[model samples]
Target: MLTQYHIEMNREALGEHFSERALQIITTANINQDRLAGQFGHDEYHFDNNAIDKGNRYINEQRGYILATLIGAGVSPSVAWSAFGRLLHSAQDFYAHSNYVTLWLDENNASSSALEIDPLTKSILLSPKLHTGKVYFPMDVVYFIKPLRSFALKLLPKDSHGWMNLDSPEQGFKFDYAIRAAVKRTKHEFELLQKLLTPEMLAKFVDK
Candidate 1:
């Protein structure tokens, strides 16, 4: 999902379920999650692929340690929520940056009953295929040639990325689908955070 969807749209959607202060905390945390990727010189962290394969367990473990450290060190809930947002971002990307959306569409088209199954379970059932082609050269070398890199990526076929395909409407992308997936992922993250923290600790961040 794009940064706007992750930060603004999701925040608005979540507002229906949470308090104003709680919404603010999660939305701000979401924004910081995107920002921190560039700050740590680990932009790939934003698009980490492991989250897709291992499901919520992986996401919980990755951010869980950091969240625990922050709370253990007496950091504010706002600070810990930021770490949680980082986890949310990765989980959200599992749909946008992977073939999960395509598979879900296929399943939904085949039978409406497929909706009875959990979306995350559907994603877990399919192996993520993020890239269709391989580059023999050091791809990062192109970054040194600014315009050349931009031109190269632009010229490459859209299908080069799992999420993009010129043949499908919405370019094989669906904002609604992405948003729904993000919301589910966020809720899961919130639940996991609640389990990891005490009621008092959780209440500090969310209305509960």
Candidate 2:
């Protein structure tokens, strides 16, 4: 479940920024910005100029997903949850809706030993360092790597699964690194949301 703190902080930090950014990357394929917008019953956003390609593919793709989540979570004026983005399932609607057993199952390779955080991943560690308080932490990002990938892979048919393991070690490792990075990003995002909440942030509801 997402907290009010999570919702408000995200709405504050990201709400003000996503539209213009989407306008900047509407042409990218596999994103289907128009279809996604229509799914939410909103009009497709427009670009400032087709020539303003200033960033890398990751910026467009990653933020594109984030923008989608924000739009979905904020669909109503009194939307009770903040966005957990890909980290959560669609049925979730509150913070108390935790499934520790599921989380434990996903990250542990069906058992308990954790993934080793390779020290060689120094450059890739930059994203998760955004946790300033106990609100989120460094090792928490390490815990995210296997589970997040497992979560994403869950979307595929079993026959189409294991696609990532087929890649070169470096490519596999890049995917590995990216999932860890996403956890940290979400944690940082939640911490930012904590900064913008009212006491209603404490209310809870059953996950849908």
Candidate 3:
């Protein structure tokens, strides 16, 4: 997803539950992921290129880091937020990069108006065919260059990221669903963290 939406959606999801300082910490960490060198080529970073297992592994690794940091002595809120933000980035990207929304719409025969509803069922999310767009090169490269983007689209495969992304409203009608799902997932992540961390650990982590 786009950087602005990443920040906006995460804030919407976590604002009421976390202090402003804590929110900023995670937001900064989230944005930094995009700034990493060769980030676009890293399938697991954005859950792109049909890298489901890699993305899942990346998320679990971050979650493990957050758990260890929080549960052990000398808890570091910054370290925990950094890992949390990285995990959230991958989770959010699943909606934008994958066919999950399309699968939901197909199964429900739903339109964009139903975008606010939760799109994931156990079956839909875990479908064997559930897959994300492949990151085709040169075409993918040109697509990022505004002047060449339209031209690139003609060459990009229908199953490629350039064609399938729901990063913004301009991409397609499913942008709303992507935003909603990402926000919901962000909150869900926080809830899971709440469950895992002791009340004291949670308080410190969130600056409560």
Candidate 4:
């Protein structure tokens, strides 16, 4: 997924699409997650191209746990929503930092109308044979070094892995894909939150 300025900007834009209080909670938590705290646990939360199901399941479990805390443990809705936003950052990254976008494009032949990936295409993307350009160990170390990072990134072929590519004209990224993925994930979050709270309570946290 995009990081630093890109992540900040995307989350800010997403927050602007929501209410003031909601935006505050989301942006605050989103930023925090990008920091050291979010990286404390399994890095799988950051990227797992081959194990999409595991990542999705982990995110869902987190959401459910947060919802339970909000309703049963008397945690503030703001706190719960903040954690939810953190989970969202990872879930959203699944598209940008994985081959899912490329696979989707290949399946649909660059058609913007089809945002949903079919089962077969998803399986193909997740296959171990497919190279998603994911970095590990010393390779990930390049992220801290600007020149080295640039050099390392240049070594990889474009469009074979993730969608974000600063060197490309379109930055090797697709706004439509990112936006659609965000909307779908947000809808799932909203639906789950709605089910866990009363109308009155939900209104306090999200715009009606």
**How does each model score on TM-score?**
0.64, 0.26, 0.94, 0.68
Candidate 4 C-alpha error for residue 51, in Å? 4.2
| lDDT per model vs. reference | 0.53, 0.28, 0.85, 0.56
lDDT of each residue in 22-59, candidate 4, tens digit only: 77677566556557665545445655434456666767
lDDT by residue (tens digit), candidate 3, 43-138: 898888889999989998999998888878876688988888889998999999998888877777585454454744788878987989888877
- Model 4 ranges with Cα > 4 A deviation: 3-19, 49-51, 111-133, 154-170
The residue ranges of model 3 lying beyond 4 angstroms of the native Cα positions read 36-41, 112-116
- What's the true lDDT of residue 141 in model 3? 74
Poorest stretch of ten by lDDT in candidate 2: 43-52
Which of the two candidates, 1 or 2, achieves a greater lDDT against the reference? Answer: 1
Q: Any idea how many clashes model 4 has?
A: 0
lDDT of 1 by residue, 122-177 (tens): 44454454322222133333522556856556555444432241212344335456
1-208: candidate 2 lDDT, tens digit per residue: 1133233333343343334333123212212322434223211111111111211232344444544434454443122232223222111111111122223334435543223322123332233321111111233233237756555444533322132211123333333332332233444544543454333332211111
The top-ranked prediction according to lDDT is 3
